[model samples]
Target: MKKPGRFLAPIVIAGITVGFLASAYKFVFSKSESSKQTTSQPQDSSNTSSSSKNSN
Candidate 1:
C-alpha cells in the first residue's frame, strides 16, 4: 500500500504539471491568434496613413 501510494504520487504530480503546461500553451496560442487578427485588419484611415508613411 505504501509503495502504491508512492507510485501514485508521481503520476498525479505529472498529470497536474502536464495540465498546467497545456493550459499555458493554449492561452499563449489564443493570444497570438488574436494578435494576428488585430494586426492583419486595421481601420481604413490608419491603414492608408501607414501605407503612405511607408511609401515615403
Candidate 2:
C-alpha cells in the first residue's frame, strides 16, 4: 500500500494555498470597502447636519 503522505501532502498544500488566496482577497476588498465608507461618512454627516440646521 502507498504511504498516506503522498496524498496528504498535496491536500495540505492545496488547503494552504486556498487559505492564503482567500485571506489576500479579504484583505484587499476590506481595505477598499473601509476607505469607501470613510470617504462617504463625512459627507453623510455633513448633509444630515445641514438639513437639521435648515429645519431649525
In terms of lDDT, the poorest run of 10 residues in model 2 is 1-10
Worst 10 residues of 1 by lDDT: 1-10
lDDT of 2 by residue, 1-56 (tens): 77778879999999999999999999999999999999999999999999999999
Query: Per-residue lDDT of 1-56 in model 1, one digit per residue for the tens?
Result: 24567668889999999999999999999999999888877776688999999999
Which prediction has the highest TM-score against the true structure? 1
Which ranges of candidate 2 are over 4 A from the true structure? 1-4, 42-56
Clashing pairs in 2: none
What lDDT would each prediction earn against the true structure?
0.89, 0.97
